[model samples]
Target: MNTQATPSPQFYLTAPAVCPYLPGEMERKVFTHLVGPRAAEMNDLLTQGGFRRSQNIAYRPACESCRACISVRILVNEFKPARTMRRVLAANSDIVGTMHPAQPSTEQFSLFRRYLDDRHQKGGMSDMSALDYAIMVEDTHVNTRIIEYRKRVPGAGIGDQPKGELMAVALSDLMSDGLSMVYSFFNPLLDRRSLGTFMILDHINRTRTLGLPHVYLGYWVKGSEKMHYKTRYQPQEHLTPRGWERYAEDGGV
Candidate 1:
């Protein structure tokens, strides 16, 4: 009979670094490795506790003086697309996303490079090589998936695979309670299509279809312009000192 007890995860704190979302501020993170047979279970628990996964590590903000980085998750069943969101969906009607195992491809890397060059040329990931990108997608210990978004080819049968131009890709972790979006990128040329917002809407729909209750959207930093979009998705819950509570734009509740 197996009677050995499982080892608990050891957490580590990252050194303070310049805040990416806010100016004149520093950010720190508390993290732990997610590996072995309990990886998936640990991921779900850690995520529900407000941690965000990157590769095999689960981390959350450990800033000393700031609590602006609030974890946000959409209430999938109660989500109602606003007119603007509905417009985004209609704009991306021709694009379809297909889920596959978390495997990287040359084509995806190419698109990723373009996205970084155009949108995040000065960001930390700007210098990531193809190998680095592959590791990001494939080095997961939990249930991860890569969803490829492409334009639907005309006359394509239901069984036919999408062969049109790749528009975007999403790397996500499927948790027991919800889907956690780890990373996503899109073709910069299609900026007018608002592919980023479309991807989030798609994930919300996917979560609903899977009978999941939430679509984890990672952190929404207050005062961060880059994070403003996350707040557009109404009826979401934000992790607070009290716990996950419904967020009211009017500042009630």
Candidate 2:
């Protein structure tokens, strides 16, 4: 028998930086590397404990003075789209997402660049190069997938890949109990499509189909207008000091 022991993951804390979601606030993160043969199992545990994966790292907010970043996960089995959400789904009925192994390509990078240029021009990821994008999508150790969204073809079957202009992309992790949305971007010009909301709704459905119970939606800052959309998916659980608890829009359990 082999007499080897797995090394424990070493955790680290990042220095403070300007907060991306809140103004005049600084942010810090506590993180650990997710690698080795146990990566997938570790990811499931860390994600359940409110950490989010980026490449090979699993990190959570470690801000000194702020607690606005709350981890949110939707109850896939219980999710019911609101009228507006249904409208978004109907608007994007022509769009279909196909999951594929995590691989980087020039086409994805080009769309990523356009998305950053139009929607996140001043954001932290705006300056990411093609190499950076590749590393972001390809440097993971856990079970990950790249879901490419395109317009559905007239004769395409459910299992066939759609052939049309690439409309959106979601980099997601398949966890033990849920799907974690690592990142996603879409064509900013298609503003009316509401592709962002559509993608989340699709993930919920996907999770349900996979027999999973949750769709992890990363952090949702209370006052951040950019994050407010995450709250629209009701019956989600918020990570608290006590543990995951059901969140209500009216501020009650």
Candidate 3:
């Protein structure tokens, strides 16, 4: 057996706050800062333990008396597209996503602004400016990348990569076992494309291409309509008191 030493990271708990997903419920988090040389390894460990990254912070739900938030990740190798998902893939065939080092751009911020305005006007990130957006994308020590989606030009030939108008963006983490979707946004005008679902689908395909077995989709809360879509990806695993196990489709909240 090979032996390697890694420093232990300190953890903290946040004060309880109003639950964003479930009404009439309070939510709290146990979080740790991801920094220094071992940030990447620490991040991977925490993520596998059900923590999610936001900029340089890794956090997981630590609510009192509530176990509604379940960490979910897709089993990519075992996934099969449903009829509706296939249709979504075909509908977005004209779009392409290019992965790049995590960096902020005016175009990306513009789309992010529109998406926030249209979908989450009164949410926590509504007041974020361009600089804050930049920090969100770049202030990280772990392996992070952004995938920018755009529509292909009419005359563009095969193997010709072009960066057109930005349509959607996914901020993802390349972990040891899978790609974790930290956050994502899309052009509000292209709701017809269902860019949200398309982004997840694209990540699944990307994971397959990379020979990764899973795609981390973050947490799913029971009784939250906003989180219901996450359960659509079948053969997924959820972190439990025992450990990660296959999620039951009919598993009640």
Per-residue lDDT over 1-253 for candidate 1, one digit per residue giving the tens place of the 0 to 100 score: 2222248888888999999999999999998888888999999999999999999889999999999999999999999999988999999999879999999999999999999999998999999999999999999999999999999999998788999999899999999988999999999998789999999999999999999999999999999988988888889999998999999877834
Tens-place lDDT per residue, model 3, 97-215, is 99999999999999999999999989999999999999999999999999999998888887788557788999999988889999999989887888999999999999999999989
User: Model 2, which residues run further than 4 Å from truth?
Assistant: 1-6
Deviation (Å) of 27 in candidate 1: 1.0
lDDT against the true structure, per candidate, is 0.93, 0.93, 0.91
Worst 10-residue lDDT window for candidate 1 reads 1-10
Error of 3 at 180 (Å): 0.2
For model 2, how does the per-residue alpha-carbon lDDT over 135-230 read when each residue is reduced to its tens digit? 999999899999999999888888877888999999999999989999999998999999999999999999999999999999999889989988
Better of 1 and 2 by TM-score: 1
| TM of each candidate vs. truth | 0.96, 0.95, 0.95
**lDDT, model 2:** 0.93
Q: What's the CA RMSD of model 3 in angstroms?
A: 4.0
